[model samples]
Target: MAVLSFDNVSILQEDVPTLQQVNLEMNEGDFAYLIGKTGSGKSTLFRSIYAELPINSGVARVAGYSLNDIKRSDIPFLRRKLGFVFQDFQLLTDRNVEKNLSFVLEATGHSNPDEIRFRIEQVLAQVGMSNAIQKRVHRLSGGEQQRVCIARAILNKPLLLLADEPTGHLDPEVSLEIMQLFKQLNQQGTAILMASHDYNTMRQVPGKLLKIEAGRIFPVNSLD
Candidate 1:
C-alpha cells in the first residue's frame, strides 16, 4: 500500500483553500522533494498530510489512515507512524539531549527504562549525535541540534519522515551533512518527503520533485 496517497484533494488553512484538486502518492522507500517559493503552499501540503490542516474535499490517506475521516483522538496515532523534522531544531531548551529524547519515548508509551535508553542510543548514533547525549540543547551548535531533532524523529522507527526545510538554518557544509543523513535513512527503507527551498541541495541529493506553485502541486524534472 502507498505510504501516502492524495487523490483530487483540496487542502484548507483557516477556512481558506490553499491547494486544490491535488493528487499525489508516496510508496514505501520513496524519496520526494517539495519545493516552492515563500507562501506557495509547500508547508500547507505538508500540514495536510499530517492532519494539522484539514482536508476540505477528496480522498487523503497517510500511513494507512484516512485524513478525511480521522478523529481528533486518532491524530496522535497517525502521527506516531510518521516522523517530523523542523527547520528551527525545536529541541526543548531546558532539557539535555537524552532527556529530550526520553520525553518523546515516554510520551509515546515506552515505559521500560532499559528499552528507552537503548532506543535513544540507537537513534542518536544514527544521526551521529550519540556522544552529545548529555549536552544541553543551548550549548549545541545548530547542526548538532538539528541532528538531535532528526534522531528524535526516528526514535519510533516511523514509516515516513516529513522534514520542513530541515537544513535551512545550517551552513552549506552542515546542510550537506544533513542531506547525507537523510539519504542514509531513505536507503534504509524509510520513505521521506522533505520541503526545501535549496535547489542546490536538491541537485546534490536527487529525488522526485514535487513543486508547489500558486497553491498547486506538479512534478518537475529539475528546479531549472
Candidate 2:
C-alpha cells in the first residue's frame, strides 16, 4: 500500500513559493531518500506531508489524511500515525529519554502505563537504544541522541517516518550508522521518507532517489 502520496502538491511560505507541483510516493516497507542542494525545497516538501505547511494547491495524503483538505482538530490525530524526526534532535531539555517517549505516548492517548512502557521499550530496542533509556538526552553522544529520536518516532508505531536531515551533525561514520538504522526500520515494514542534502550518504543508501531542482520534484535522472 502507498503510505504517502502527493499529486501536484504546492506549498508557499509568506507568498514565496518553496515547492511547486510535487508528486511522489513511498509505499509500505519502502525506503526513499530526498536529495537536493540547499534551498532546493527538500524540507519544504517534507513539511507539506505532515501538514506543517498547508498545501497551497493539489492533494497530499499521509497515512490517509488529506493535506489539502483536513480539519484543525484532525491535525494532531494525523500526526499520531506519522513519525517526524529532525536533524537537530528536538527532545525536551528537561526530560530524560524515557520521559520523552512517554510524553508522546500520553499525548497520543495511550493511557495504560504498562502498555506505554512496553511500546517505548520495543521502539528503543528497535533503534538499539534500549540500554540508554535512563540516560539524560545531553549525556548521550550525537549519534546516540539521534538513535533515541528514531526510537521515539517509532514508539507510536507510525505508518510512515519522515526525517529531516537526520545526519546533519554527525561524522561520516556516524551518518552511515544512522542511515543503516533508517534502512533497518524500513525493512521491518515502516515506510521512510527522509530529506537530506548529503549527496554522498544518499548515494550510499540503498533506495530510490528523488530530487528537487529548479522548483520541481522528480527522480534524479529526470533532472537530466
Candidate 3:
C-alpha cells in the first residue's frame, strides 16, 4: 500500500516556487533517500507531506490524508500517522527521555499509563537508548539524543517516517550508527523517506535514491 504519493505537485516557499510538477510514491516498508544540495527544496518537500507547507497544485497524499483537501482540525490526526525526525534533535530540552516519549503518547490519545510505559520501553530499546530513559535531553551525547529523537518519533508506530537530515549534525561515525538504526527500523516494517546529503553513509546503507534538482524529483542510479 502506498503511504505517501505526490502527483504533479507544486510547492512554494515564501511565495517563491520550489518543487514543481513533482511526482513520487512510497509503499509500505520501503526506504528512499532524498538527496539535494542546500536550498534545493528537500525540506520544503518534506514540509508539504506533513502540511507544514501547502501543495499549490495537483494531488498529494500522506498516510492516506489528502494534503490539498485535508481539514484544519484533521491536521493533528493526520500527523499521528506520520513521524518526523530532524537533524537538530527536536526533543524538549527541559524533559527527561521518558517524559518526552510520554508526552507524545498522551497527546496521541494513549491514556493507559501501563501501556504507555510499555510502549516507551519498547521504542527506546529498539533505538538502543533504554538506559537513558531518565536522562535530561541536554545531558545525553549527540548520538544519544538523536537516538531518543528516533525513539520519540516511533512512539505511535507511524506508518511513515519523514526524517530531514537526521544525521546532518552528527560526525561520520555517529552518522553511520544512526543510519544502521534506520536500516533496522526499515527492516522491521516502517517506511522511511529521509532527506540526506551524507552520500557515503547512504551508499553503505543502500535504499532507493531520489534526487531533487531544478525544481523536480527523480531517481538517480548513483549518488555522484
Worst 10 residues of 3 by lDDT: 41-50
Best by TM-score: 1
Give me the runs in candidate 3 sitting further than 4 Å from their true place.
none
Global fold similarity of model 1 (TM-score)? 0.97
What TM-score would each prediction reach against the true structure? 0.97, 0.94, 0.97
TM-score of 3: 0.97
CA lDDT, every model vs. true structure: 0.92, 0.86, 0.93
Q: Model 3, residue 91: displacement in angstroms?
A: 1.4
Which pairs clash (backbone N, Cα, C closer than 3 Å) in model 1?
Answer: none
lDDT (Cα, 0-100) at 122 in candidate 1: 97
Looking at model 1, which ten-residue stretch has the lowest summed lDDT?
197-206
Q: Write the per-residue lDDT of candidate 3 for residues 1-224, one digit (tens) a residue.
A: 99999999999888899999999999999999999889999978888898989899999999889999899999999999988899998889999999999999999899999999999999999999989999999999999999999998988889999999999899999999999999999999999999998988998999999999999999999988
Best first by TM-score, ranked: 1, 3, 2
Worst 10 residues of 2 by lDDT: 215-224
Off by over 4 Å in 1: none
